[model samples]
Target chain A: MDEQETRKAVHDRIDQLDVPQDLVAAAIETGIDQASGKQVKPRRRRHLGRWILTAAAAVLLGVGGLAAVNPSVSRALSNVAWLTNFYLHHDDHFNSFHVNGIAKSMDQKVTSNGVTVHLVEAYYNGRTIGYTGEVTGLTKAIDPEQDWVPLDLDDTPAKNLTSSTSNFEPTKSGFRFHATFLVDKGEVPESVLLPIRISNVNGVVGRWNFNINLTQSQQKHAIQQKPYDLDLPGGEIIPVSMTTFASGAEFTFRTTTDGRYGFIGISAIKTAEEDQLIDGTDGYYASLGITHLPLKEPLVQGKTYHVVYQYQMKTDGSPEADIVGADIERDIVLWPAEQ
Target chain B: MELTLKEITWAQQAVAGDREALGQLLKSRGDYLYRTAYLYVGNQADALDVIQEATTQAVKTVAQLRDPNQFFTWFTRILIRQAQVLYRRRQKETTMAVPPEQVAPMIDATAHLDLLAALQVLGADYRQALQLFYYQDMSISEISQLLDVPEGTVKTRLRRGRSALHDQLGGNYYG
Candidate 1:
């Protein structure tokens, strides 16, 4: 059924469950009586009660993570895994939820179906971000004709910079590094990928770091492009240079006649499924959290661009990565400066 | 003007510790407040407790109110807050086991199992949002204000929750 019909039915059912009359009277009386009993006789000389009350209220507000520390409520909502997983934004121009995690590397293998896909088979590390792979695509329901579908936040992929809790601020934690590219036409921009490892090398032991290897796609969506610089809302932005690492993957620039050197590299590869992906299952859709998106306008001819984020092993200022003793190099490269 | 004078006289008498005037005021509003509380907690017993607690708290607090005309919204807000507090507290401790006592009642006797299954399937946000908006007859702005979220956010929740509930019910929501 269509969306409007669905809403009407639920609204109707809720309407049918009316609260009995006697209950309302009891509730009002309780409120009035409760208010009357709280009047404190004004102390003629001492006046320090208000400050104490404010301090106590502040303490109550500072309790541990409202969801995790509260067990009973979690159990009540336990059946709702997808809703719980999404970043709950109580305020935003367009309602949005974000999938956040830091992975050293994700495996990449593209088949010859002409449909390039990122096969995420593992839920390990943190590559397991989106609610469902089928629900993916910045705007389209993975399968548009399905009798079942997902609620898309917007028809475009937004560079998310918000978190679930208002006071639970976002920190420079858990991200290795990210790369971004905006696709356009004329010159096809190569797929941006990076493989990251998490093992600490500063004589540090015990915690297991990670190793990720990324590959680029041969399909080209560009005809002409230019060097694009991305500005992120949080964390630092660095430049990539011609450098050789242990795996023989070097990040360098493709200099044009104008003397501007653009960048190319791998970002992630996937070999396993994430915690929740759209696999045809009976109750799975209800339980599965899928990120739905649709591109309203088709990719600009000869002007398609994408931002591939590059991450480091250390998160939240944790000095776990020992690469050249620098905070694992986090960088971004836009394939074409012009489209 | 006459009714205003009457209300003022009653308020003065109530403030002066006239138990009868207080009783009249309590009886006048008791049922309405209880219904609001019931809509929030979704349980008669819990609703009763919320009203009792809010009543006690309001009694001690209302004497300090400047404008008693705001009695309905102010009192409703308190009851809503009390239910939310209990819901939050309950979430923490019942992580592993949620007894049937806490679930919403079945809508139909014959379709009890199916309805229970449907409600169980509906996400907490959707069910609660639907309950508050449709069952409680609260205004969209009221729900958003009470929940400390933007009005648009509440609309999105209602949309999503209703869609999911429709899926669970195996037909268009209009059914």
Candidate 2:
């Protein structure tokens, strides 16, 4: 084949592969939503969140809390070990869930090619859906640092799925896996069908699929909600209804301005006693629509925390990273102390 | 490969934080992006993942593109980087039990199977240069700018890649 023939062949070969237009459109919509800060990118590496929380964890020390880890489920199979370990070693982000009793036991299992993948338990708090499971039957232990567990949701409702972060640990039989899938859609359905597929296990290749049902947790209700009017520079007084939860806070506001405006990030959430500096997760940055902020520490009851945010011109992609309570014109929404 | 006036307008609007315009721009280039990603990853699922990730990055950094006419090149660069990231990450996990057919999927290229195989055997750098130069209809300078390499380096890769393909196919494939 000559150069022309080769070019035609290359084009023809690439064209042979079908492009799913629906999926592509969905991805574009998702990307726009995330870039505009309607939602966060699904999977975040979280090294920064963890490192910043090291100090918050120290401040939260001796702040005793309690709630029973669901007693009805089999303690042996439903390995909440991932959550327990995360709370113990990594950070106290999951401590609120543990205290709020927000986990559901999903003791489902699928086995293939001498391997068993157990979908043990799941925690769904409106915004995030996390799963912890066990994998038995491996030739050798997996190094979680180097090896990735190929557990992924299949393509039926995958368009709604944004990002997922997973962790694996070596077990005697195989390994245990913990993964969290972020749902960016504002109104999450009562139940979502997660068709999980594991394409590869160690060097053993085969599809180990599981159709796990995820029901949204009822405990996600706002413990405290209040209406506060935010005065924008353009003389636009946007009424923001802030809802605080054990997980984080949700800002529900509508803007009718012609100028492009979106909720970027909250710089600080302050109380009479403590001023907690937030990583960008505290709020989604953008020009319009609802913004969900996952807070590092749960709001303390009977404490009036002042959630202060400043509107600044977007420098790079995430200006929230550099937000350091600089003396700029700011907006404050008062969350009157929870009684 | 030339940018149309409408596309240029959409790119400008997209960069100016117009979601509708951005969505339109992405839909226009969606197929091309998918094919490019598929070329690197060699599968449907991974290719889709690459596109989605690239789309997210594009939306995040579209403002960084100073030239609206260069949207295709800019987005392609993002897609290629994502494809490489996923390809390298998954290379370690895939096993030998998976048949070659499953990896590349079935394409009706009975006459061009040898060509495809030869292209696959070429090193990553050679394959990229060849694909950009031939399939993407890009000049050496354009390929150099996209790949962030000197124009001479791209020309060398194209020459060496053509020689390698000619040696395999037993003809002047690049003539």
Candidate 3:
């Protein structure tokens, strides 16, 4: 069909699209009450949250963010919270850490009765991540009165919201970097073990590290922290007005297992533990006072070594209680550091 | 308590816990959201689910909206997001137990799908950007405001969305 014919066909079909009755009822229920009061000065979306998290891990693992130095085990450390995703695949030459996965969703929505949120992933196989996914549900577009830092998708910020705009530029997305690129991938090391810390209402539950470049026998040696501290990867904190028997605490913290870019949040839950963990603890960091190890050319890959830290925790001694330990493991591959 | 009260009564009653006003608002725009959703999702149930979520999100965040005139665009973005979310969820459920081979294959080779199939080819961002630019007949600036993207990024997405469509529709790309 010609362009005009195709346009007509598309237009014809669009007009015929029937809107569901119940859906109309639901949206109409929204009644025209607009949000116009308080203004929130929108800073660039939070990126340092990832950095602080890795710093927390460095405090835990003793090596302090050196896992990226080893290229071999980089994939193993990239495992995430529950869905267990984002395996980094690298060709012989380390240019980009190609990540692929069938993006998943937590189909948690009810009719006009309940609401489910979809978080948008920034990048998928190197495509611009759209505003879909549960993350979008977590963010509210700033009210117009509020000043917003033009979105910088990369891990940096320079402002894009100007008086007028142009067409065709990477910065044009009004986002500086693709969301995925916001967390730059580290090179692969021969073997790397990053033990990360997580805190919860139960106290600081535990620390788990991903050991990439593990030998067949070494995979089992991967560290596993029980009672998965939903707050390990610290997130935005919203004060709660109510609590329940099953849910009594704000449990959240940080994670370094997923490399520099692995920042996760628990938006809402049957229990507030996950939500507290993600939204809380943005200002937390164990003051790095002790002398960190300084010996070899950094924790490079293929060189096995154990990391040990002397740290303290909150009073809870329960399995989910807060405590600290030394990071001990061996034999890692060293990923070349980019000069 | 009056006849006119039933129709325009929502203006105030909705704020005072009047379920009728809530009911009226839903009755009016719910279908609109679902239609926009269906365009993106192509599934009835998924589209309906998207509408509900979009409504709820609107309730929570609409307070931040400046004027009511932008509700369509604001809620459309939400509906589009809802459709994308539903599609992702359905894709996950449909593949829950399917082994590696039975799973929905990634769009590696684009030569096999038809025009409609090609519409399904572009990822959510690319497809939405194209639809907004052409089907919606929205100017680049309008697309930017709607998509919350910079205009240049809007053009890039439009270009890529068009190219992907071309590949999927046997080199028949429409912007």
Best-fitting candidate, measured by TM-score? 2
Weakest 10 consecutive residues, lDDT, candidate 2 chain A?
A: A48-57
DockQ of 3: 0.10
Name every residue pair that clashes in candidate 2.
A42-A163, A43-A163, A261-A287, A262-A286, A262-A287, A262-A288, A264-A285
Q: Which has the better lDDT: candidate 2, or candidate 3?
A: 2
Each predicted complex: what DockQ? 0.12, 0.18, 0.10
Error of 2 at A23 (Å): 1.6
In terms of DockQ, the best-performing candidate is 2
| Deviating ranges (above 4 Å) for candidate 3 | A1-8, A22-339, B1-26, B29-31, B91-116, B170-175
Question: Per-residue lDDT tens digits of candidate 1, residues A1-339?
Answer: 554554465455544444444434544454455455644321111111101111121111111111112222232211324323322431120012122121122233221111122222111111111111111112221232222222111111112211111111111211011111111112212321111111111111111111122222222233233333433223222322322211112222332211111112222211123111111110000101111111111222323333233322233343443322111222323223342
Model 1 chain B worst lDDT run, 10 consecutive residues:
B102-111
Q: Point to the candidate with the largest lDDT.
A: 2
lDDT of each: 0.34, 0.58, 0.35
Error of 1 at A254 (Å): 99
**Candidate 3 chain A worst ten-residue window by lDDT:** A208-217
Per-residue alpha-carbon lDDT of candidate 2 for residues B34-83, written as tens digits (9 for 90 to 100)? 77777776555666678778877988888888988888888888888898
Q: Which ten residues in a row have the lowest lDDT in candidate 1 chain A?
A: A280-289
lDDT, candidate 2, A19-55, per-residue tens: 7666567666766676667864453222101122111
Evaluate model 1: give its lDDT: 0.34
